[model samples]
Target chain A: MSQRPTAAGDPVIVVDRLTKHYRVADKDPGVLGTLRHFVRRKHRVIEAVKSVSFDIAPGEIVGFLGPNGAGKTTTLKMLTGLVHPTAGSVRVAGHDPFRRAARFLEDITLVMGQKQQLIWDLPTLDSLRINAAVYRIPPAEVRPRIDRLAEMLSIGDVLAQPVRKLSLGQRMKAELLAALLHRPSIVFLDEPTLGLDVNAQTAVRAFLREYNAEVGATILLTSHYMADITALCERVLLVHDGALVYDGALADLVERFAPYREVEVELEHPVEREVLAAVAEIDTFEGRVVRWLVPRDALTQVVARALETLPVHDLRVSDPPIEQIIGRLFDGRFEGSAAPPTHPPAA
Target chain B: MRRLARLIGLFWSTAVAGEMEYRVNFALAVLSSAGGLLGALFGLSLFFGDTDRFAGWSWLQALVVLGVFTLLDGLTSTLLVPNLGRIVRHVRMGTLDFVLLKPVDAQLWLSTRDFSPWGLPDVLLGLGLVIWAGVRLSVSPTQALLALVPTVASCVILYSLWFVLATMSIWFVKIHNVTEVLKALVAAGRYPMSAYPAAYRVFFTLVVPVAFLTTVPAETFIGRGQPAWIVGSVLLALLLFAASRAFFRFALRFYTSASS
Candidate 1:
């Protein structure tokens, strides 16, 4: 997709060159350094988020993709006004999140997968009512909105149970419902589907998509689950070591980094390894099947040649999985660092 | 106003429910807390045995002060202690992130997050002693002398003082020791300020106001009512409450949630 300037005016969240550096104390083992450490404490600066920029239009669903410690969570925290950026400008709903003014807080909500906002020992229903009062939503509308969300998420029964007794996925749904009960226009979800089963993950993804459409809420989600990004997000912002590495359409990212589809052929018999190498970089080779990393544009040509020349029996070609592409991208070894494994790569 | 109070009540009940999950631990905790106050009362009795009217305050009057202090201490421990203890860990672990994103004031949330229903025993025992003192010293303690109003007001003031110090955790990230220090100060309230001298009352009533926490309030029931004491206690409580709120907001400026 070509770059298109958003017409949504100034973007709901416009973060430019955001940075966060934490000062951690430095100490050595043994009683000597420990003793002196208290007298003259020394600190080392660790940059957690370094010069990241992104813009999300109204109603945009963007995925923040990266491995752990990639600053995805740091960026989300700054956007939600939960944390301050060391340097840079972050304006969510046209107000500085760090300011944490009542108006700005009212327009946004954040959900953390590993953390919960519900009162742990209370029934979710009680927590929901509390949140309603907290956000000052009209009492008349709270129950209906809550009921609709509960029904849609299939969490109505769980709402009566204590939060501690509910399953992780159940608690997560309740959290999401409570978060949206205030009708926030901008939602920040950090690892919302983590530790959930595949079915629960799918259910959550669907609910999020529906909620965004119904409420016109802009969503920025950070998840290590590539399937989450592949299924729900239109665009993805990739962060690496506290910096924005790539920001564009999810499809475009795969297209750019994984520009080629992988092709694999199962030969009738084990052939000389040179023949497999001659066609393309042999990804893997075992008894009969061999795999090659070939450009998408050259897939047809390579497959045709392999079928004709090599005692070829069967062959297939497909785009590399998002997980493999991402692993290669972070490792910086996608480009000819080593020969691809020789095997019939699964589509 | 009712809605807010009800929300706080629910919060309190939830805390009780969390603790109830472990019945053995909860029973032991209640017993230990009760034992602590029993020990304090026993110590007070021993001291009274030596001098009935030490420092111009009688044995029963001293016990009144001790009773009020135990009640106030129980309230702080059951309601404020657990939550205040968690402030540092919340800041370090980023749990405060969830608290802030909510629509309520961060200070209000932290102050009311946890409550220990087990501490009810202390309140009951304290009330029994206060009534027993009231009956023994009845001497037709007039409507004016019944100091129940000011006594309750003083409890509110003392609790507010603790809230102020606990809220300081928002500013000084390593304020886990602040509440412990406050508890130590409360321990000093068990004895009469008159024994130390008039100067200590002035210091505590003005500087830290620890005296009003128990002594001035207990004095109300013991026919030590003074209009000046009532006015001073209320004014100081309101002033301290306002100052604590301002300090809390000031601390918010430096608060950077974790991983942000």
Candidate 2:
């Protein structure tokens, strides 16, 4: 939402004040409103994204971060040419995304989380071959690419089985391979590591990093998983309420927004409430365990004071969790004393 | 054109290869088609037993008409019907986004991909029934060849008609119920258009052209239809096909591809 960082790198994807607004019918909450809506439908506009501007450079993986319904996916859809922007302009790979030219399509691919391109009843390889044909890839080129991808993902055997028979992780691996068979220079991946276990998640993240390094493909990835952004993206964009809130380096964002280090102190016994409260803003104090949200600007002084006065049994100082930092941003409130809802949103 | 052919060939081969894993399913499909052919023939015999001519057409001629209807309908199952279902799923689940992102023509791939190998048996059975009826009527191979002209036109018209229906799903979801109405129209073509009341006969013959799909083809073989009808059928097919293409493009403009 703030900062004017000097422009850097060759921009492969340029989005200039992109916007998308959907016209949905307005419905009443009650029976009378329902009857009125039925007689003469009232329509309302939902602005999914508004005046969003960003540039993704060649070989750079940019993280798109947002809460549900915050227009992260909408931006991706617009960039990938699946959803046309209601206003503004976008160019990916030197072509207008809205035009969706064959050349543009050939040079870009979008892989959505939990959405499948694989044919369910067919072997994963069968689906890949079909995709190859549709892409007009020479038949001879398909086998070697598929072989190499399968080996890289360690999914050669997985591809031999029907898609429905594979576990979720294996299916996702195959899904990524299917999308990448065309070797598009520009990739839009929305939650590519979703629903994967820790091992599978790590495997997919490693694969993406290697692919980007080897092929120099520009990747725009959106994920609820901070690990995905942290592991693969050097820069991150924060979207909130249908607008760009932050666009800069990931570390810069962490430094600017997450201005606190979390400290959890385990005491020898339950201490007087006044003792812990006097040292730092107590996050929680239960039985013998105590926690403090220490300001990052003064983290050293805060911890030293706590160590000198408190009966420290076990102490831990760590950067605040990604969810908390992002959550604080979305809360649109910088006063760290008060907390936002910590419960995960319903899936 | 060669690339399109290659694409279709690969899609079909992949479908067949996947289908081959379940040999029992293929066998059952063959049996089902045989049973369906037998049932249609039995119905024809039952109606013809009452008289040599029903609505001024012999039993063999009626048999030929039924044969044309079943054959076209069966072949449609091989590609069109399954593809329609796939399109519906894609539209409903927002998976159509992936389809739109492909470098190929979305409509072409959606129409031709993943045909049912099992439907091949029904096609063969329909062809056999047609030849059997031709033999009973003493129709020559030349007559069969002549009938092929209108038969091909009828298939083109039928595909266009079905395409129009399937394309509507882009604008309005839940068009599966509309295909049942099409089945009723196809059933009307199982006999001569003259078999219905005069008003109803004219409606089916000209307006919807259901009669042109089956009765006209059968009449060509029976030496009762004129060559003009063949030309008319081809013209109508071309007209409807262009209309369907336009309608599909118009409907596609409305596809939001929204996750909701």
Using lDDT as the measure, the top candidate is 2
Task: Please report the candidate that would top TM-score against the real structure.
Answer: 2
Query: Quality of candidate 1's docking, in CAPRI categories?
Result: acceptable
Candidate 1: which stretches are off by over 4 Å? A1-10, A119-123, A137-143, A266-272, A296-304, A307-315, A332-347, B16-52, B59-64, B85-89, B131-153, B164-180, B197-207, B219-231, B250-260
Candidate 1 residue lDDT tens string, B17-82: 677788787677668867887798787777667667777788778878888877777777777778
Q: Model 2 clash pairs?
A: A1-A245, A1-A246
Q: Best candidate, DockQ-wise?
A: 2
Residue A215 error for model 2, in Å? 0.5
For B26-128, candidate 2 gives per-residue lDDT tens digits of: 8898898888778877877777787888888887788888888888878776877788888888888989888889887777878887688777887787788
- Residue pairs with backbone overlap in model 1: A283-A340, A283-A341, A283-A342, A284-A341, A284-A342, A284-A343, A285-A342
- Model 2, A59-176: lDDT tens per residue? 8888999888999988888888777678989889889876678999999999887688888887888788778877888878999999988888989987888899999999999999
Each predicted model: what fraction of the native A–B Cα contacts (within 8 Å) does it retain? 0.49, 0.65
- For residue B238, model 2's alpha carbon misses the true position, in angstroms, by 2.2
Chain B TM-score list for all models:
0.88, 0.93
Residue A240 in candidate 1, Cα distance off native in Å: 1.9
Q: Which runs in model 2 stand beyond 4 Å of their true positions?
A: A1-10, A26-40, A260-319, A332-347, B18-56, B135-143, B222-228, B258-260
